[model samples]
Target: MRITAENFIKHLKKNREEALQYVIDEYIGIVKAIIYNALKSYNDPQIIEECISDTFLGAYENAKQFKGDKEDFRKWICTIAKYKAITKQRKLSKAPFFYEIDETGNAVKSAEDEYLIKSSTEELLMMMSQLEQLDRDIFTMKYFLNMKNEEIAEHCGLTKAAINNRLYRGKKRLQQIHLGGSMS
Candidate 1:
């Protein structure tokens, strides 16, 4: 049978196993990208894979609630993926040994904490703006892209030493900006 969002939803709700294959084929890429954007910083493939599975499982479990409209599939799955990713991120952010039991009682951060993280990210991006373009690019690749120095060096056709120098100087400059010191 042809797969439509309506048909897919019906099969899923009815617990027809083959419907999963259709959903995976149709939606896995978008689901994965959403998860990746959320979990990029952690760099854990296992966590990423688990979140993707959870997202699908969530859709299956909630299939009855969905109207089974194909037009709504993308948005619905995206919402599920976003929440699943956030949940996984919160779980990974809390380290068992880092905090006392009482302090770690709530692993999930409040919405305000999420806002602060966003603000901090914006501030850091703004700080990076003070550096020369090459310095900024190098810094982003190393930190945001989480590329190894050797990988970045190869990409930029520079030596590993060059990458390190730019990172050090860029950091110092950003620090100076933050400290309100005269640029050296």
Candidate 2:
């Protein structure tokens, strides 16, 4: 049967399995696409998967608040996915490290390392902002959401190969710009 927001809400209110399943089955592709596009820049796929799961769980918990059209739902999900991706990125950047100073009056822990990381973080954010909206979306989904190319393709109405191509080119461009700016 076809599922609408009204029906979905009814299922959610009643805590029906079918409704939850309907949402999962129908919207998983869309959710995956939203997630993957929002997280494409992250190098760790595991973190992206966790964030994607968190995004879906958040949607499930807050499904009752979805009081808009289907398109609005899509946008809302995408927004949540993007926010989750950014949060994860911030977490990665803030990851702690231990350093020890060796002998010879040389400092093993240097201030330059900190500055380089800080600068790279800023450069990444700046380069992300410079990307086209569509490219940003694709990047987020692939990297932050940990989605496979086929799923993104289905959700975005593109072929699997096309999604792969877009992701490849987008990543190459982002890396070039970000690294090049930092080096310069």
Candidate 3:
């Protein structure tokens, strides 16, 4: 059968098994590519596969909520794949790995450094969670992705000044949260 998303949606609406299989067959490449781009820096095959699996599972389980052009399915799936990758990134990166594995598989970091790294990361993520969603994304891209202000600005289509303002305000909010005080 032809593999347009419209055909897939019809089969999905009917709860046919082919819808899932067909959607995976037709879209896994693009989905995997989107996920891979998000995960390329880590190079962990297991996490990548899990994110991809979760993406498809999300699509299948929530198929009824998808309403748009069949041709636009690729974009929708890519967005899902990106968020799946982000969730996996959060799980894998909740704490910074202060230690590098040595040649014989021993960690090369001091205990103090590990504690500081974990504690700082936990506090940082907690503070980030309190920011507005767009600010959170910008902060993550800046610090987590190691993107420069120019790159984040370009990717987000905002001016460099706006990106700087977001970073400044985000850091201010982080301090406020850490101090156990409200942003007044």
Candidate 4:
């Protein structure tokens, strides 16, 4: 019996290895993209790759609980990838740092410096969460991913001017929140 999209869920529930392979073949790109986007600051390819694997493993293990069709499965896998990457990020932040020597023989990023950077990033993300979903996504793409306004516009299906306007307003809102003012 061959596995098709229509029967994917049924096969997955049976714990068929082919079903897992089918999912990997079909959705690896989406999984990797979500993991990479979530872990962009890590600068460690190995960790990102590990998170991708973990996401697949999670989906396979949790297959019985999944409902809905192929489109839902794509969303489910993406959600798994996102949470796995976040878990990896949190674990990395809590782990101790080892000093690495640069070409000039100077150590890069003291433990304290790393902690400060991680904490500040967490704070920024918390503030970003207070934004409307679209504004939050635009802010993340523009600032965290370092994507250009044109690219963000294209990705978001908005005009560059709209992207600019949203960014401006989002910044103002963040500033107000930072200054102990409530979001209006």
Tens-digit per-residue lDDT, 58-142, candidate 3: 7776566565556545655665676667766654565347457788875566687646544554455456557776786686567
Worst 10 residues of 4 by lDDT: 117-126
Q: How high is each candidate's TM-score? A: 0.51, 0.45, 0.51, 0.53
Between which residue pairs do clashes occur in model 4?
none
RMSD of each: 12.6, 11.9, 9.0, 8.7
Better of 2 and 3 by TM-score: 3
Off by over 4 Å in 1: 1-6, 97-184
Better of 3 and 4 by lDDT: 4
lDDT of each: 0.72, 0.63, 0.72, 0.76
Please report, as a residue range, the 10-residue window in candidate 2 with the lowest summed lDDT. 92-101
Better of 1 and 2 by lDDT: 1
RMSD over all Cα atoms, model 4: 8.7
lDDT of 4 by residue, 4-93 (tens): 889888998899999998999899998898888888888889888888888888788878766657865775576566656766776676
Rank order by lDDT, top first?
4, 3, 1, 2
Runs in model 3 with CA error above 4 Å?
Answer: 1-5, 95-184
